[model samples]
Target: MRSSTIRRALAAASTVSMLALSVSACSEDTANDSTVDFGYIGDYNGVSLLAIAKKLGLWKEVGLTAKVKAFNDGPIQVQALRAGNLDFGYIGPGAMWLPASGKAKVVAVNTLAYADRVIAQPGITSMKDLKGKKVGVPEGTSGDMALNLALEKAGMTAKDVQKVPMAPATIVSAFSSGRIDGAGIWYPLIDTIKAKVPDLEEVASTRETDSSFPTAFVAGNKVKPELTSKVIKVLQKANDWRARHPREAITESARMLELDESKVKADAANVETLPTADLVAKTKDGTVDKWLNVLGDFFVRNGQLESAPDPSSYYTGDLYTKAYAK
Candidate 1:
């Protein structure tokens, strides 16, 4: 296989990775007086909320300790949450299906207006250009969602192109070495690919078809609403701090997540972190619900789901309101 810095990092890591702050415990059901088992994506696509929460001591301020674990992607994180291995998880677009499919409950929106894009070589300027080309994307991810939607918009489908299912990190070397004609992935690594393939061009993005692509925090069906509320509260505090100290937030997140600070900064460039107050307002005004519906439809049409479930069944916007109200 082709190799690069990111490829090496991802290959060296596993789905059940532990965060730097994670405490090794024998039992998965370790929720107790103060500690909660939390999971977040170990990839760069993940927002730094959990990392920030740990770095700024917001967890202690909120009177809780998080036993954080890192997973390779949203789907794996959701799997852990569903199996009761996690009290909570930070997830991407998979939130649309996980909750509706009776796997988890989305408690709050973490980041909004973020994107997963299809980046291609110079010659592949449009989605249609990829009709017979090999496209690399970690299947069952937000990136896969974007690629399918973009293909549909261009009057094509996944069958029209060769789909190479690889982890996000591997896409770097795959695209750079011309092993794949294009890649559907998110940033930080997108920037990394650009540096390797100077003529790299983003042909499609989630923002094109969906107004907003939001990442969220999820909990199992049995998790108490109170605990989720407290977690969201701490996340809100960290989001507030992150907005005020953007550079420091990136550096601190890099330190906490064991990623390069420069790459983290580049990846965060287009990510828009909404305040808890704003998320509550959006939920009240039905904007968030609409986003969820759009996301659900995307999955259904992509054949990932039998049908789209009602937004209310999965999204609990009241949780955001309640958390921010505190």
Candidate 2:
């Protein structure tokens, strides 16, 4: 990730940034169609194939000149996708509503291996203690999901607290200054904040429910349609390289987030990167289908979507099949 991009890792979530997937001329093929405008969340967990593909020069060899942008939040990325300013995106549950709402599609997915953790201020020791306190979370992101889960585990909900909306990168500042009492976020960013305040301690992690939160690489419904298959091929090649060179993959991902190697390595172990064929099989056999249903139901119950569409319709394995053709 670019240092400038990493610097804003915690920008607050924006309510103004709707998915806005209205048909626009922006998702059209550009003059230089070989270039793919890929925007991804800079969170290290989502860095798996994109950063490695760049480091290995895999995308270029696969006939793509990627124009990468790192956004601090996913909804904003959807905003760009809506305007046709982006071709491909790696988004998390925070923005999965796009695909679930027929605005985009999931071309690939990442394992729920990397779950989120909660860091509490010294005075607040456990999830139960967060009642009525001000807590920071970027709304709709995985961190928020984890926070909600943890709160429920403690017999509370969003209604029980003053939910301060802010990016994980910015949470530490507020926390130390006493603006917020705790923060729920992903690994490195959570760790980054902890480094600044050693007295703060970890209280809860969403490991028990990690399997329910798979990360997805989504494409706008009308994205550079022709290159979608090519993009998936390169992603597969990158993941193959990662399995063969686990340490190197971890190191490369760490470099992108500018985080400690061990932190990335620890998180990497939890995230199971699935192969294309298996993901395709799962997608078709209702394994992936069931997961999407659960997610859509959760989002709707939580008031994110009005009605859930057929989750299976949002993905297709045809590209994966053709990508491996003889």
Candidate 3:
């Protein structure tokens, strides 16, 4: 009787252990299905729309629980995505070549033009006058790329000018101390500099030069493919909200960026937000393709990218199609 009772207890313990393992497996699967992480490049003019989306609950409206993280620059953002630290974020079009050559994928073009501006000190009049003068640029950035492109267009190169690598934060000081003759930067910083420097002149704008250069929304190649559509929905909703509420968007963005409202408004006027879903249609119809191809080839010739990437590899239309179609 004693032996039989011990056998029964051991059998019951084994059964309970198996049941616990099954439950643990199910729990693990459920947890894996629920979370997503997203990353965005650090402060820039284009980030305002994304800020409005977060403030207005657009991400929640689209049923995405995103962990929005910020990085110092687009190149860093690309590195994060490559390391599986991000689900999606905005990146410079020129920087996209790094990931396109590897495992990352670009889902859509967020901004279709370079909207940055070159602001110079009072006495600096034109691009010609900029020669031999010190210029400040955020190294390895879109602003840097634009400045380089502008120089090339003027029959000059980086070697012709003294290019000073400075952070956007240090630009004002660099200019004030006569360390740099001009600064190439985007909004908030541009507006801030203008307000601080009474004698600043608007030399050239990125929008004025490369109107077709593509800024993008990129995702990790390993993310669940189905989530791509959801990501588009979030971006489109944010963009639409920005369009409808420009003032509010500006105010909110200004608040987040800690800039003057008028300055924010002035900068906002120069930006044109492109719909993420429209990128593919625009490309297939020869609009985006032509523009991106031109910019790509330009960059290649200027030594930005090793070669012009295949247009299809640089953009994915299916996600946009599904998001808009829904």
Best by TM-score: 1
- The sequence of per-residue lDDT tens digits that candidate 2 reaches over residues 241-324 is 777788998888777656667766766765666666677677667787777777787778667789777876786556655675
Of 1 and 3, the candidate ranking higher by TM-score: 1
Candidate 3 residue-wise lDDT, 1-326, digit = tens: 00000001111101111100001111223344234566554333445656766676665554555565545446656677778767776666546555546557777666654556667889887777888888897665666766766787788888877888875556755776666898766554555565568778877767666356677777887777667876677677777677677788777766654556675566556556665446647856877667667666766766757887766775666666667778
RMSD of each: 4.4, 5.8, 15.6
Better by lDDT, candidate 3 or 1: 1
For residues 1-326, what per-residue lDDT tens digits would candidate 1 score against the true structure?
00012211432223465644543333333465366788776543354776677776777765677787766567777788878889888777744577767788888777774557889988889988888899998777777777887888888989999999987767777898989998877755576677779988899987665367787878888888777777778878888887788788887767765677876666576577776667788999999888888878878888878888887787777777877776
User: Candidate 3 lDDT (Cα, whole model)?
Assistant: 0.60
- Any residue pairs clashing in model 1, and if so which? none
- Candidate 1 overall lDDT versus native: 0.72
Q: Model 3 segments beyond 4 Å from truth?
A: 1-30, 41-45, 93-103, 258-260, 275-280
| Better candidate by TM-score, 1 or 2 | 1
Model 2 residue 162 distance off true place after TM-score fit, in angstroms: 0.7
